[model samples]
Target: MTLMKAVTFRDFGGPEMLQLTEVARPEPGPSDVLIRIHAAGICYHDVLSRAGKIPRDKPGQILGHEIAGEIAAVGSNVSPDRIGERVVIYQRLFCGQCPYCLAGRQDLCRNSRVLGENGGGGYAEFTCVPAQNAIQMPDGLDMTTAALAVCPIGTSVRAALGVAKIGPGDKVLVTGSGGGLGLHQIQVAKSVNAHVIAVTSSDEKVDVIKQAGADEVIISPDLKFSREVWRLTAKQGVDVVLENVVTNTFGESLRSTAQNAKVVVLGNIGTRPVEVDPGLLIVRRIRIAGSGNATYADVRRSLHLLATGAVKPFIGRVLPFPDVGQGHALMEQKAVVGRVVLSGW
Candidate 1:
């Protein structure tokens, strides 16, 4: 049995629970590819999982999803020549024969599971995933940038375009606009020529939010930004609201939307519940859709936009693999301006 260095926590608690240890290297199954992980992004979701907020992400599971690497080997069923291709992982495990997967909605597959739950994850030097999940990174896209291709970027694609159907002349609002997903979602909405209004809880992030292509930035540390949204849209409200921080902002997001507008909820970082007024939802005719993860097509679109520079990844920091605990602290404190990617294992 070959051994590889990996970061995994035997018990769920704080970032310190994540320890460096040796584990058996995973071998690819018949339809899988062995990936030599070059870089991996630290997502807020990882922090939540580490705190035991997610029941499915079991203890001892390697916790990372935003991955980029080169194929180091292949299973018997895979072509040997493809071993050297650079790729970004698709971020989910799914039964391919499911109806949703067949229709390209892999995120909605009946058997869908996050990669680290039952398989090797990107925190390690190597991981094995289905061949179809290894999306080829476009030429000139660095490993760090490609590491974010399927996550903050691809999920942005799903929220802005796939769910909200944002288009030219649309009024789009993005909450948590200073964070990793927020900055990318703003850029994705702008890529399609939408009018974007960004909201951030941190006053220090206003300029960075603006730099990420938000037409307007509102600093509301207390989640009191709906009135400002009303003022900004001239009482018309926004056509779409991308709610990345849904715990405290769900109500605000619903209030920030126009009649017939779609509100796409990407996450509730706190894992806490928020009260909602059904009457307000009814009167506004607001359609709230929950979105997470990305399909193969969404990842492909994300890569194209990234490769062409239509959307630039906001990489705030890059730490060596051993500094992953610091990355978790930064994410938990919401201290980073954008994505934190880990490499140099």
Candidate 2:
């Protein structure tokens, strides 16, 4: 029996719960491929899971989803020639026959499951995923950059370009603008010629958000930035808003939009519910959309953007495989500027 090293939590409470363990090496199924993971991105989602917030991440389960690697082995049904291919893993295992998948909107696939929560997660030395979930890495793109393609990058693409449909000269406001998703979404919004206003709770991240292409940065530690947003836009407000910090800033995000603004809620950093003003929605004709995940096409677009230098990935720190707990600590403290990517087994 072959054993591989993986990071798993015996109990979900603290970063210390994440411990290295030897586990059975996973073998690919008939339609899957075994990948030798080179990089796995540590998201806030992982930190939440460690804190017992995400129920899908069971105790003792491997916990990382953003992954990039080389195809080391192919399943019986997969072509042997595909081995040695460098690829970025798509996080969801979507059933192709689902109605959403049939419409090429697999982002909403009902039968889909997230990789880290439901399958062979990437915290280990290797992981097995369906053959179709592997997206070829663009030429000259490194593993670390590819690791973020499907997550913050692709996710931002889906929210800004696809869901919000941001266009040239559109006014875009991004909440949590210094976060992993915000850094990339700023660039995505700018790529479409939008004027971006970045909002962050930390003053330390103000300059970082501007460096990431925010036309304006608002340091709103108290989560009240709507007034500044309105003043900056000359009372016009923004045309689109990408709300990455929903739990704390949903009301402000809604209040900071124009008459017919499109607001895309990317995540609720904390899972707690927020109070919504239905009157504000009715008066402004505000359209709020929630994106659970990105489509395969969004991942492909993110890769192309990365390759062409349209969107540069921001990695706060890169840790070795065994130091994954450190990444979680940094995330919990909100000390990382962008993302924490783990590499070097």
Candidate 3:
């Protein structure tokens, strides 16, 4: 059996749990493809998995979801042309036979399994994924940007376009606008020619948030920015609110939206309970939607945007594979501005 270096953890804990060691290189099964990972983007979900917030079937799991690489080998059922092609792996594992999968809504498939939570993830030199999940990379795209194209970019596409139904001339407000998802979401909103108002707790991130195409940047240390948003829109409020900080900013997000507006909830960073007023929802007529995972179509659209230079990838730090733990630490501390990618695996 051939061995490859992987970052593995036996018990769910903190950054100290991550261990760099040799593990058996996975072989491609029928209808699967073995990829030599060139770059793996770090996400908050990976941090949650390491902290035991996300469940695992067993111990000793390689944890990473955002991945981009070259197809080293293919299964018997896959085409030979796929070999040596650079590609990005769609993070969700879904059963293609399901109804949702047939409808191109694999993000909602009942038989879905998340990459890092299911089995071997992208924290290794080599990983095997379903052949359908391997999307061919465009000519000018690099592996690092390709890895970020899916989640921060593609997922944001789904949330802004598909879920929120953002349109031209609409006013969109994005909370937690300094992080990976928040920064990309601002650009996604701008792609539709919408007026984007970005909110962040850190003053140091205001310049980068503005650089990411936010029409208005709000530095709110108290996580209360609805009044500022109201003032920015001349008291009418925004048409859409991309709610990234659910726990800290949910109530304010509702308050920041216009009447009959859509509020798309990405994820809860605080992971705590929130108190919402029923009267507020009744009066504002706000629709609260929970965005699911990104689909193949979403990934393709985002890649096109990136290839055409309409959107740029934000790589805050590129760390060697051996320093994976350090990447997690920086992410935990919220020191890094954008995506943290691991290379040289």
Give residue 213's lDDT in candidate 3 (0 to 100).
96
Native-to-model Cα distance after best TM-score fit, residue 266 in candidate 1, in Å: 0.5
Q: Which ranges of candidate 3 are over 4 A from the true structure?
A: 56-58
Give one digit per residue, the lDDT tens place, for model 2 in 1-345: 889999998997999998999999999999999999999999788788778887766788898889999999999999999999999999988899978899989878889888888547999999999999998997899999899999989999999988999999999999989999999999999998999999999899988898889999999889999999999999999999999889879999999999999999888888999999999999999999987577889999999999999999999999998999999999888989999999997
lDDT of 2 at 306: 95
Candidate 2 — which pairs collide? none
Candidate 2: segments with Cα more than 4 A from true spot? none
Could you list the CA RMSD of all candidates, in the order they appear?
A: 1.0, 0.9, 1.0
Compose the digit string of candidate 1's lDDT tens values, residues 1-345: 999989998788988998888999999999999999999999888888888888777888888999999999999999999989999999888898988988989999878788876548889999999998998988999999999999999999998999889999999989989999999999999999999999988889998999989999998989989999999999999999999888888988888889989999998877888898999889989898988887788999999999999999998999998889999998888889999999997
* lDDT for predicted candidate 2 compared with the true structure: 0.91
User: Candidate 3, 100: how far from true, in Å?
Assistant: 0.8
lDDT of 3 by residue, 140-196 (tens): 899999999888899999999999989999999999899999999999889989999
Per-prediction TM-score, please?
A: 0.98, 0.98, 0.98
